[model samples]
Target: MTDIEARFWSKVDKSGDCWLWTAATTYGYGRFAITKRQMIGAHRFAWETVNGPVPDGMVIDHLCRIRLCVNPAHMEVVTNGENVLRGEGLSALNARKTHCKNGHEFTPENTIVTKNPSGNGRACRECRRAAWTARATCPECGGSFSARNLARHRTNQHGGSHV
Candidate 1:
């Protein structure tokens, strides 16, 4: 076995569903101190030691949801988005939500999509309409207007020549 593989096996307990890391940990996940400034995740290192590079934009996920699990059989390579959606956390809960805070169902016609750094989110059309109307305050008269009425309101109130 390679030196990394040897080091990895030495720290594993191997006594339960999760071949728990017996070495140091960070934030409840196994942490291996390779060098003074070369510390890395023990589970990730284990995956690399057995498999290869984790793949671009892909992360190693514990099938058993054990942060300390370094068992190669329990690891799967997946995208960050896929991992988040599969996890039992707040992000997963939000991803599974089919309705907006206002109780509007997220249908294809009524749902507005937004791309974010973490993932995409849907907004209800009714809530969006309300927001567009409520937020479109006139710079000239400070009056709110809906999307359909904003242009006419701006042109008529500002005399159409107000730059």
Candidate 2:
């Protein structure tokens, strides 16, 4: 084996089906140094060593879900979105929901596509409308007003002490 190959393999524990890297890790992924100052994911290194460079716009997904696994066979190349949707993260969990938390179906008409900090997301229109309507009522004076007029309503009707 070449020097880098030998160094890479030396840190792997091959006892299990998944070849676990037993060295330094970052965010659960094994870290390997290819050069004195450059470091890369050990799983990516293993996949590249076996199957060549990963294609642009594609990321390595651990099919085994073991971040420490460096076995190329346990990995797959997929888009970042695809990778996230395939896993059990919050985005994936939300994507799998056919209905909202309040039992409203996420139909084309009922679903509102929104931009969140993470990315695009779907919200139930009924729930959103209900929430907005709930906010439109003044709790102190029991008066109904538009959402834009909430502060004005409170200031004029309740002297701003109701907030």
Candidate 3:
């Protein structure tokens, strides 16, 4: 094993949770219970111990499914996307809820998609619902508009102002 890996493994206890050294920083700035900094350090140590420096764009995945585990045997190199999926951190798994705060259910019929500069998809169903509600209430003039003509109603009947 590389010297760094040997040093880390020698200090790990049986449970593989605690580290020999307290990590200076944790994942997501302490969002996760496991210290990711220590995990990275341990991974670096392991990689150097057995295979020399890790190549660029290589991410270490935990085969043990334990974020804090530093066992060299349990670490494997994988793409960042694969690592995120393996860790269950994909956006699809944590997308916004189907219903808004007002209990309005969002479906394709009621949803609007906005394009991000990076060409990513961002849905504004909640915003669309809020706009519809606002058009109904006419927050400024307190008048309702027909659902189909809310946009024109807001700009014309509501003093030519966009909501």
lDDT per model vs. reference: 0.85, 0.92, 0.57
TM-score per prediction, in order, is 0.68, 0.81, 0.49
Clash count per candidate = 0, 0, 1
lDDT tens readout by residue for model 1, 14-52: 988779999998999999977668998998998888888
Pick by lDDT: which candidate is best? Answer: 2
lDDT of 2 by residue, 73-108 (tens): 999999998999999999899999999999999999
Weakest ten-residue segment in model 2 by summed lDDT: 154-163
119 Cα displacement, candidate 2 (Å) = 2.9
lDDT of 1: 0.85
In candidate 3, what are the lDDT values of residues 54-93, reduced to their tens digit?
7789877777665555556777888886776566544544
Model 2 segments more than 4 A misplaced:
132-152
Candidate with more favorable, higher TM-score: 2 or 3: 2
RMSD of 3: 7.4
Which residue pairs in model 1 clash with each other? none
